[model samples]
Target: MLNELFTLKGKRALITGSSRGIGRAIAMLYAEAGAHVIIHGSKPSAKLDEALAEARALGASAEAVSADIGDINAVKGLIQAVGDVDILVLNASMQHYQTVPDFDPETFALDVNANLRSCFLLLQGFLPGMQQRRFGRIISIGSVNQWRPGARLAIYASTKAAQFNLVLNCARAYAADGITANSISPGVIDTDRNAEALADPAIVEKLRSLVPARRFGSAMDCAGAALLLASPAGAYINGADIAIDGGMKL
Candidate 1:
């Protein structure tokens, strides 16, 4: 049953912010593992549809839904569009790294809404169905900053911490119904958005020094842990915040 433990042969997963970055990678991987995936994002993007279609071509059912996750009305509309869900992956998040003198109120609020509040909204829509079915997996993508707060990102760090604790609370509240809640805190991942920061020789050196593994994480690193918790292999795992940071906090 080893393969069965990791197989998502007939599952349905809803992944938010899947147009690019880590979200996109996770969506594609989950589909490859045999789950019907619903690609979600803010506003409709042809590219997102393309990703969904590609997954369908790979022998998995997939679709795309566009919704501004931070907007309650929009999120409600999107939820009504897709009725019930078996798996939920809250991977949409916003970040603003600005020093005190330059930080803007609007930007900070946007980060809070996207990173923390949006998670609440999504769960509000899907949790009930999961409870009724007595089977569900909810995984939220958090940040390493929650455990290792960084400079110029206090607000982002706060939201990540919120995700971590919320998972525990949600798990405890829903476990008896056979639903599981978990979070993945990823370290500095090598993505298009982070290339510039990591390209700086000094910053690169610093990052390497900070992580015991002396390397940056790839989308695959976080995706691997996510799949584990969202699959049968993690049936007994709940109320957990898994860290995939290559020992950066030590």
Candidate 2:
């Protein structure tokens, strides 16, 4: 029955920002494991539909939805679109790279809205259903920056840190209802967005030196942690931050 513990049959999952990258990986894996996956992106696109189609190709029920998650009204609309999900993945986030002196207030607010505030709003919309169902999994994608802050990443780090705390609070608040909340923290994953960051020979070497694995991680790495956490195998793993960082934090 070990394999059955990992099964997601009959479970409905809504994963925000799942059109690409780590979120996409998790969405695909969940569908492959028998979930009815909702692939959510910030806006509608052919790419989003492709992901939905892929999930269906995996022999699972799937659909796609779009909304500006940074906007509370849009987040509400997104919740309505998906209805009640047994698993919620808060993976949509934004970042601004600016030194303290160069930091723009508007950009900072945008980061807060997209990262932290949006999480709160989503919990507001989904938590009641989870509580009533007495079976829910909430997974937020956190960052290593929360523990190891990088230059020009103050706002990003702050939001990530708050996300961790929020997960802990959620775990405490909903444990009695049989709901679990957790975070997955990734480090230097080789994604399209980080391709340039890892392109420079000097930067790549420096980053490699920091990571004991001597290479950047893949989206599938985070997806592995997520799949476990959202499965029955991880029923007792609440309020934990699973780091897919390849020992970068050490």
| Candidate 1 lDDT by residue in tens digits, 205-233 | 98788899888889888888888988889
- Top-lDDT candidate index: 2
lDDT of 2 by residue, 35-93 (tens): 99999989989889899989999999998899998898999888887899999999989
Alpha carbon deviation, residue 21, candidate 2 (Å): 0.3
TM-score, candidate number 1: 0.94
What TM-score would candidate 2 get against the native? Answer: 0.97
Candidate 2 lDDT trough over 10 residues, lowest sum: 96-105
- Candidate 2 Cα errors over 4 Å, as ranges: none
Candidate 1 residue runs with Cα over 4 Å from true position? none
Number of clashing pairs per prediction, in order: 0, 0
